[model samples]
Target: MDRPLGPVPAHAALEALLPPTALLVPEPAPPWTAGWDERDENDGFRPDWLQVRRLVRELMPTPKSVTRERMAEAEKECGALGLDGLDGGEGDFATLWTTRTGAWLAEEIFEGLTRLCDVMDLEPRLRDFAEEYVRRGMTVEAARAFMLAQ
Candidate 1:
């Protein structure tokens, strides 16, 4: 992993500006699209509106960004798959957009997310995170969390 070093001052400056971008890759894809697995079901189920709102808010980090649209699509897929007992009432696209999120969940929206990530260039942040975790304001767990977030 080691490479040649630049002068100390330039190295420091480069580190401050950005970490190496090659290492940060999105997490592995998720499994499950639809269909109930009875073994995974629970007896009681209740929706938590507070958690729902918070979770939705978290998804819509950029006030008026495409994430909102993407979320709606993912939700639709989640509903369909979940109602059908696919996830036993719990499902998320997570990193599945790499596949389905709910693959067929929201076809257009899933495609849009790919475009959005391309337009946003998330790989750069990913790369820096891989290069050096501490410099970018993340704990070891937080670094793992970032991968999970993707």
Candidate 2:
């Protein structure tokens, strides 16, 4: 089959690689409305970022050549985006729910996720899920509900 030529939607890309049951315990969808709230005021960093990384490894249908250690290393390198002090406009909050500390669902994270789909030959699946995800407006709340309802 021919491969998709460009980046896939982030959440769909992630869902395609994770186990079907990953949503059994869905992370609390961060409230994007709370734009630029301080991390200390809101709480600590959001776990959804790292949580996705963990799920990708834990829920693989088959263990590919990639090792857990390698995944960890990937996390170390791309994991923490000093999400503290992102001085972007409120409109930026539309896609990312960031804290005053600056941590958020950045594009780089999604890029990494979609790249994983390409490596795993899951781009077709990602495409399907991406369509659904887009239909739901690409909101985390909708993604959680859709995954759970499945």
Candidate 3:
């Protein structure tokens, strides 16, 4: 398992401006979508309210435009998947996507952003942060983290 670049290909990047329309799948609703809100927030569970409002407004950076778009897209995708009118505009979609596909979608978002950074000549940042961590060393864990620093 090798490539022209160190680990990730040169073309791999993130789409920081908009949520990926194609990435949303509308079938077989994620299993964990049920009772997601009832889970203990103290655990590693993705906070359901984080989607509606920033968890720590002062500490957390304002969401990018694409982040907003992603929320809208997730809502629409939910409706398309026969999940319309869920929770009446609360963080229902966020809960669903996060519980069911957050980790997976997060990886996809990270890879997409990496590719986007590459296209925008922001590869240096990716190399310093994401690629190096993924390539050089660290016990790779499936922990959820936002990859893009920009």
Report the Cα RMSD per candidate: 14.8, 13.5, 13.7
Worst 10-residue stretch by lDDT in candidate 2?
94-103
Candidate 3 regions with alpha-carbon error over 4 angstroms: 1-10, 14-34, 41-50, 53-106, 109-130, 133-150
Give the TM-scores of the predictions, in the order they appear. 0.20, 0.24, 0.21
Native-to-model Cα distance after best TM-score fit, residue 150 in candidate 1, in Å = 24
lDDT of 3: 0.37
How much is 115 displaced in model 3, in angstroms? 17
Prediction 1 global C-alpha lDDT = 0.34
For model 3 the local lDDT of residue 139 reads: 12
lDDT string for model 1 (10-48, tens) is 234334433233213222112223333222134433323
What's model 1's lDDT at 142?
A: 35
What is the Cα-based lDDT of residue 138 in candidate 2?
A: 39
Q: After superposition, which runs of candidate 1 have C-alpha atoms over 4 Å from their true positions? A: 1-66, 83-150
List model 2 lDDT by residue over 1-150, tens digit each. 123333445544345333333232223344443334335345764444444434433533222434555444433443364322112223322122211111113223333444454355443554455344434333334333333333
lDDT of 3 by residue, 45-125 (tens): 533333433321222233333254566665664455444434334545554333333333334445545445444554454
TM-score of 1: 0.20
